[model samples]
Target: MSTSDPRPALFDQWLPAEYRRRGDFTVLVVLVGIDTRSIELLSSTFMNVIGDETRWREVRQLFQSSETDWNGAAFFPVDSVIGPVPNDMARTQLRALEEKVRADRRVLNGGHFFDRKGRRLKVEEIVH
Candidate 1:
């Protein structure tokens, strides 16, 4: 949250309660360029960072889904302040991201959410 953008931190705050107490993390990666915009989600495997893998598995079993996990999540592609950006621009943006990642940048990290039982989840929730 040190950067000018606060969307990522906000997303981390809005995750379900189940994931938070356990320290699970989620993040979204968006490619923004001249004509293409694509979304790539990243997250830690539930068992990788969670201290209690057994308990985590049990909760997953009980919920039959991650619908109840409260892990802190974040958004990416800090640019592209709007929706459905052009695909070419997105591609360009992605290329830029690739370069940054290659340079060891901290651009992409964390886990993402998915639609389950009628709930729709996005990798990064864009905030303007």
Candidate 2:
């Protein structure tokens, strides 16, 4: 998506000033084709691979997750209001998890990640 994508507006439904004051940034990352169970377990899987639950947990605590049913398929709408991570650290971790999960073509086959502005970014955007 371009910088003007309106979808990014949904990224921050309610980012509290207190969070931002602490350098926390609210973000939205969308993943499709994953069951609700996998979505719930995603955090654990992520931490397992990175071995930095402290950094991950700091962001994970503010997670707000939901699922969308469209045409009988499920889409995960995951967002977090945690940040202050230096240099887009959360986005990097999220992209890593997205690619790793989809690599095996298992439960999570595909999805897209977006920045806080709702701008859709390619996996490469964050991977490199």
Candidate 3:
């Protein structure tokens, strides 16, 4: 998508300060698609293939991770809030969520989550 594309717009335009407070930056990178080699070239010419390759590896590791530091873990939406999804199922569940979003805007409003304490919370914005 172009920078002008509305679906996956720039981070600052969409994410709120609350989301950036902890600063793990993995989810940010993923949402921004910064690890994609083509997007990296489009985003900046100063960064070369080495940087992109490194980031690609890092991004892959994060997705393969079962657990991460608080900041990384914090990026994960609570399952009950989103569904009965287990933490290990994050990748598959997220793909489904993305597909649902593409199929219907109502799913954006439909998704919800529950915290460890069982508090109900809606997935207000994918990044918020």
- Which candidate leads the pack in TM-score? 1
Q: Which wins on TM-score, candidate 1 or candidate 3?
A: 1
lDDT of 3 at 65: 64
Q: Candidate 2, after superposition: displacement of residue 107 in Å?
A: 8.1
Could you list the CA RMSD of all candidates, in the order they appear? Answer: 15.5, 15.1, 15.5
Q: Write the per-residue lDDT of candidate 3 for residues 25-54, one digit (tens) a residue.
A: 222111212221211111100111111123
TM-score of 2: 0.24
Q: How far is candidate 2 from the true structure (C-alpha RMSD, Å)?
A: 15.1
Q: lDDT value for candidate 3?
A: 0.29
- Model 3, which residues run further than 4 Å from truth? 1-76, 80-88, 112-128
Off by more than 4 A, model 1? 1-74, 78-82, 108-128
> Considering summed lDDT, which 10 consecutive residues are worst modelled in model 3?
39-48
Q: Give the per-residue lDDT digits (tens) of candidate 2, residues 1-128.
A: 35664332222322232233333332324333233333322331121112212232233232333333211111222344443333355567666655665564333323334232333333222232
Better of 1 and 2 by TM-score: 1
Give me the runs in candidate 2 sitting further than 4 Å from their true place. Answer: 1-28, 33-82, 104-128
Question: Which 10 consecutive residues of model 2 have the lowest summed lDDT?
Answer: 44-53
Q: Score each candidate by Cα lDDT.
A: 0.34, 0.33, 0.29
Residue pairs with colliding backbones in model 2 are: 8-117, 8-118, 23-84
